[model samples]
Target: MSDIEFPDTLIALERAAWEELQAGRLTVATANAVQDAITQHAEAAGMSRVEVEMALKKAVRHAEG
Candidate 1:
């Protein structure tokens, strides 16, 4: 992963997706499937898991800003 974070839109989309999963509208199996899809996409895009998490944090901060 590069030093750069993910774009705000991506982070927001991820956060919303996560919240929906947590609320159980998305089943655990379905959420895992979605997460896997996201992970695969991120890996293909050259982002590490840590980088993705950092990006999410950065995105949240940016949203507050």
Candidate 2:
């Protein structure tokens, strides 16, 4: 993994998504919400939205394994 760092909001949002998934409540809508949150955070932080999205997707996939 790269040394890229995420903003607190993005990290919190990802954590929430993982929690929801663990709780068996991660619906498509919830996943979309997480993505939206990431977008918002990326914009606020002046970070690359694509990078953050990719990182979050990778995180979700890793969590599944």
Candidate 3:
């Protein structure tokens, strides 16, 4: 795991998305919106999509565990 720092906004977005998933409120539209927000955040942060996605997966796994 690289020590890449993501913006707080991105972290919050992931947390909210995960919460939505846990609460079974992750509709397709909501998921799409989250993806779009993540992509925009990543771009603004100068991070690649792959990097952001991998980090998000790691965060989700960590949250689940």
* Least accurate 10 contiguous residues by lDDT in model 2: 56-65
Clashes of 3: 0
Once model 1 is optimally superposed onto the true structure by TM-score, how far is the C-alpha of residue 54 displaced, in angstroms?
Answer: 3.2
Q: Rate residue 26 of model 2 by lDDT.
A: 84
Between prediction 1 and prediction 2, the one with superior lDDT is 2
lDDT of 1: 0.59
**Cα-based lDDT at residue 47, candidate 1:** 75
- RMSD, candidate 3, Å: 2.9
Cα shift from native, residue 9, model 1 (Å): 8.7
lDDT of 2 at 33: 77
Q: Could you tell me every candidate's TM-score relative to the true structure?
A: 0.42, 0.54, 0.63
The residue ranges of model 2 lying beyond 4 angstroms of the native Cα positions read 27-29, 41-50, 57-65
Candidate 3 lDDT by residue in tens digits, 6-55: 66766677777778889988777667766887788678889897787778
Clashing pairs in 1: none
Please list the residue runs of candidate 3 whose C-alpha ends up more than 4 Å from where it truly belongs after superposition.
44-47, 63-65
Candidate 2, 5-65: lDDT as tens digits: 6666666677777888989888887778778887886787688888878787566546453
Clashing pairs in 3: none
Better of 1 and 2 by TM-score: 2
